[model samples]
Target: MTDPELPKLVLPGEYLGAAEQFLPGRGTYEDGGRIYASLLGVPAIDPADRTVRVEPRNAVPEVREGDLVYARVDELKTAMAVCTVLSTVASRRQVPGAPEGTVHISKAKDGYTESLAGEFAIGDVLVARVLQAHPGIKLTTAPASLGVVAARCQVCHALLTLGEKEAVCPRCGHREHRKFAKGPLPSPSGAHGPGGV
Candidate 1:
């Protein structure tokens, strides 16, 4: 049978063909008698065996436990801080889907965390370690090396500068407490650089 017309490139879960017409192959899955693309790639059907497959164009970066990652705090709850994982620190690649990660108050710092608002503010960029990668992403900023790497003043929204014991906003002169990561900010270019901020 001749191959059916298919999109040049397909996204994950895009319908491809009927399972009866094309055998499910690599990067394709069969479900309810239908074939679907399993990744971002070009879809094709093998004429000889009638196998449908998607040739991956780019590899998706996987997040794993113990990996260092950069994330932005989106919301602060009583017991946890919700964040969107931005990228993997080592690879410096943006995480696909922008998975949500949470930092429990107990893992916010080394000791007791009186309030999530005290340590993290909305839009604060954090450098945290992945404590759990599956089921749901769990993060930890308790280590001195892992915490808010960049934060803005809550009052004026000016970028805060590192100070003796807290972050200071030059514009508003507002001082805020944070569990700062013990290193310099990652370069705007997404590369790691030296010198503490």
Candidate 2:
């Protein structure tokens, strides 16, 4: 039965509960001990087993290999960067499942990367190419045109501006390194760059 206290409807990426309280069932994913809806639908709980799931309202787009996509970095591990896929650059549509994607250290850039943390930070928005779509999503930002398109200053949390050598924060005058995308930089609304918005 659906929980009486939970919302009648939930959108993708909406938090449902802690992992300890309920097991994630179909249409739900657990990350960092939190359960979130993977589809736009009505949320329901199985009282018999303490599982939460979302019943989809409609069809959603699928991520395919070779597609360009925007994703947000959620965590940085030693050899991989964990991210949540946000949208497809072509259609600008939000991925329904908000599926988890990973970028191996080898796929981060064209050359050797000594550290994953140096290339990415939590919350940085990246423009990546899908290397594998099934089993598990794998991404790469190795091309000159693909990489971090938007990032905030680690010190100030203000949007970083493109610099010749690094990303600079206007507010704090902080500078940091990133594997940036080539060509035009995206505006605050993400409407200025190629295939943006």
Candidate 3:
């Protein structure tokens, strides 16, 4: 059987073919006996299987083990810190699927962590490495290049600057302890620049 002609480029919601003719596959959906592209991609038609699929032109980045990521501390408990992953450092793309990660106290620092309170706090921005992506996104800030990159004054909400062994709020002069990453802050442009922090 000859392969059916397919569109070189298809946009979301664009009609592909009748469901009776082609089974909907990746990047496609079937409704009302019609197949439509679900994403911007190239449509592929398999004659043998009578399936139509669209291959996305651009793939969304996903979090993976050992990838560096930027995250904001969402909550802190005695044993762990919960964070919302902002983006991946390498691709500088927002991770798809799972955006939440957990940093166990054991992965917070090098030494024994008495509590997560001193190492992390809500709203603190950190750079961490993905330890696990499936089941759940587990993170680690124990490396020298992984830890808090930016933070705010817990009392005044002012942006804190890097200080000797801690982050200090210039406005409030409040010094908060943290597990700081070793290096300058990640660029605001989302470019993975030199330096860990």
Candidate 4:
């Protein structure tokens, strides 16, 4: 019976389909008692039941059409600003190599979003959406639940929020220009599916 403590299952990324469990150690996978697989880019591990689970890894990036995405501002223009994609979903940490995306001022919000400084800033994390993909992808954030998740103060490392036309830190009352949201933001693309997720 192989003792009950001889490392029951394996990891998700280490599985390849075979008799019994085939997931390698530390691969991370999903588990369903009979079969284990990966869930939400990560492997499903009880980390308690000690099971093996894994699934076919999706090769595409996780870009949902109209999904809010946390972005980092790089350059700003008179009306618009060029930016780099930071994260697709809101989490403690961000995914690596998710591809750089953009967010136009017009698509920043539905109302008069004022200057780009009032809405976003350099290295600011913003929640935007994917407006267009043809001739390059165009981004926008006019949704209420699809905005900033967390903004930092320019002076202190306190959390900030959108007050009037700027970000105000609630901790030290330090007003800083940054994007933030209540929770995890949406993806900066209009393609939601099993492709690049």
Report how far residue 124 has shifted in candidate 4, in Å.
1.9
Residue 122, candidate 2: how far off, in angstroms? 0.6
* Alpha-carbon RMSD, each predicted model: 7.8, 13.0, 9.1, 9.3
Candidate 2 is scored at a TM of 0.64
At residue 8, what lDDT does model 2 achieve? 90
lDDT tens digits, residues 83-183, model 1? 99999888899999999999999999889989999899999999987888999999988866679888999899999996645998999899899888885
Query: Which consecutive 10 residues in model 4 have the weakest lDDT in total?
Result: 33-42
- Model 3 residue runs over 4 Å out of place are 1-56, 184-197
Q: After superposition, how far is residue 141 of candidate 4 from its true place, in Å?
A: 1.2
Across 1-197, the per-residue lDDT of candidate 4 in tens digits comes to 22343234334334323325443323443344233333323434335544434333444455545555566667777687676666555442454564567666776766776787776666566666666544455676566555555567777877666654467677888766443444433343434643222
Candidate 2 lDDT over 25-126, as tens digits, reads 999999999999998998999988999999987656688877788999999999999999999887788998899999999999888999988888999999
Query: Would you give me the overall lDDT of model 3?
Result: 0.82
Q: What TM-score goes with each of the models?
A: 0.67, 0.64, 0.67, 0.52
Write the candidate numbers in order of decreasing lDDT: 2, 1, 3, 4
lDDT of 2 at 136: 97
Model 3 vs. true fold: TM: 0.67
Instruction: Score each candidate by Cα lDDT.
Output: 0.86, 0.86, 0.82, 0.54
